[model samples]
Target: MVTYIARRIGAGLAILFVIAALGFVMLSINTDAVVRGILGPQASEEQAAALKADLGLDQSLPVQFIQWLGGVFRGDLGRSWFTNQDVNELIGLRLPISLSIVIVVLLVTLVVAVLLGLGSAYFGGWFDRATQILCILGFAIPGFLLALILVTVFGVYLGWAPVVGFTPITDSLPGWMRSVTLPTIALASHSVGAVAQQVRNAAFGVLNMDYVRTLRSRGIPEWRLVLVNVLRNSTVSGITVLGLQAVGLLGAVVLVDKIFAIPGIGEMTINYTVRGDRPAIMGLILVLTVLVIVINLLVDVFVSVLNPKVRTR
Candidate 1:
């Protein structure tokens, strides 16, 4: 297990380095600065040369990469070019907000999806048909559009909650939850449908296995026969849905955060990208990359646990 985890971590690090190199190259070239130079508005040639030297932009790409990699190893994520602030500090402030929203959305999506999906599987006909329709409808719409629709009906028309801004859960859990509820729902509803689809597939597959027949032949209680052995076999696929749902929740969270006006890393990222704020952009991108890497690593571990043969492999 240790060896397996180490190998995956090493691969993730290598990918991170490649992405970092690309982002650094883009920033070092500073096309905006080049455009400005061509336009001849700000800084003289001598001043520009001095600025390049100070920023180490004149260094060879290899040397710059080495320095950036070294700083990362030492827990120093370099200063932002657009803002003088430290990248780590900025990430520290914003990551919690995004994480909190993700956690809430994940829980709601998981519980609702499992209950509805399992019920649909256990009780066929009308229940199954209704669930299938919901899954189709939810999966059909785009996340951003769904969020806007929800905002219109739930926020604008009903006036149940505030439209935007994240109130810190640390300061007030109830207030924060109220502000976040609609956004979480908008972000996770489609994910629930997706997860339900996977659940239905997994459960149906489990129901056909020889073990299920064996239990049925033994005259096992009908409820226990369906719930215990059947559910266990389906869990691996259900876990696949859970992981996918959580991941889907992340991107949609960005859109949902925008619609609901939540103050999260996604919000910060949008602002930076819009204004071409290099430092903030780099910081947010790296933070997001780290999060993806971490969650994917967790997914691998989960998959292995569900099937021990995977661990041996």
Candidate 2:
């Protein structure tokens, strides 16, 4: 198990390195444009050269990458070209807000999806039909449109939750919940359907497995039989879907964050990209890439735990 986990972590690190390299290359695509962004489009060539030199853009690509990587190792994300503030500080302030929304959305997706899937599988008939309809709608509708609709009904019409802006949880828990509830629903709506379908399919298969049938014949309590034999076996696929949805949620939240007027990493990223703040953009990309890699690694480890044969492989 230790070896398996270590191998997974090593692979995740390698993935993160590749992501960093790709992000750096992409950020460097318009070198002169980046310099112009720093010095303004109207600046003379001399001024651009001066600014570039000052910002170390005059350095070779390999050296620049090494410097950036070293800074990252030391927790220094460099200065933002737009604001001249430390990129790490800027991200630190906003990361929590985004993380909170993402975490809540994940929890909501997992809990609701598992229940819906299990119920749809166990009950069948009308319950399954209704769930199928929901899954179709959830899968078909775009996330942004759903976010807007939710904002209109829940925020404008019902006035149950705030439509725009976010309240930090530290300042007021109730206010935070009220502020975030609609965005959470919007972000999680599709994921719930997607994951629930996976769960339903997996559960259906597990329920009909020979081991489950034998367990049922032995007259074990129905709840235990389902929980131990069915649910446990079904969870591998459910977890795979869940992890994928979680990664998707991270990306989707950028749009959701904008619609809801939240000041988060996504919104920050958009602002930085618009201003051509390469350091900030690179930092954000690397952080998000690491997050994706880490989540996948954890999912792999958890899947292996659920099925020990995976460890041998």
In terms of lDDT, which candidate is strongest?
2
lDDT of 2 at 58: 91
lDDT of 1 by residue, 1-313 (tens): 8888998899888887778778867766654464344335766777777666766667787897787778778888777655667888878988888889888887887778877777788788999999999889888887788778878887789988776777898889898988888777777768888888777878887777898888889999978976677766666676777777676666666677777777777777776665555556666666677777887788788888767677676
Cα lDDT, model 1, residue 214? 89
- Stretches of candidate 1 off by over 4 Å are 31-40, 216-227, 275-278
Q: Which pairs clash in the backbone of model 2?
A: none
User: lDDT per model, in order?
Assistant: 0.75, 0.88
lDDT (tens digit, per residue) of candidate 2 on 56-174: 88999889999999999998989987789998888899989999998999899888888888888888999999999999998999899999999999889998988899999999999
* Model 1 quality (TM-score): 0.89
* Superposed Cα deviation of residue 71, candidate 1 (Å): 1.5
lDDT of 1 at 19: 80
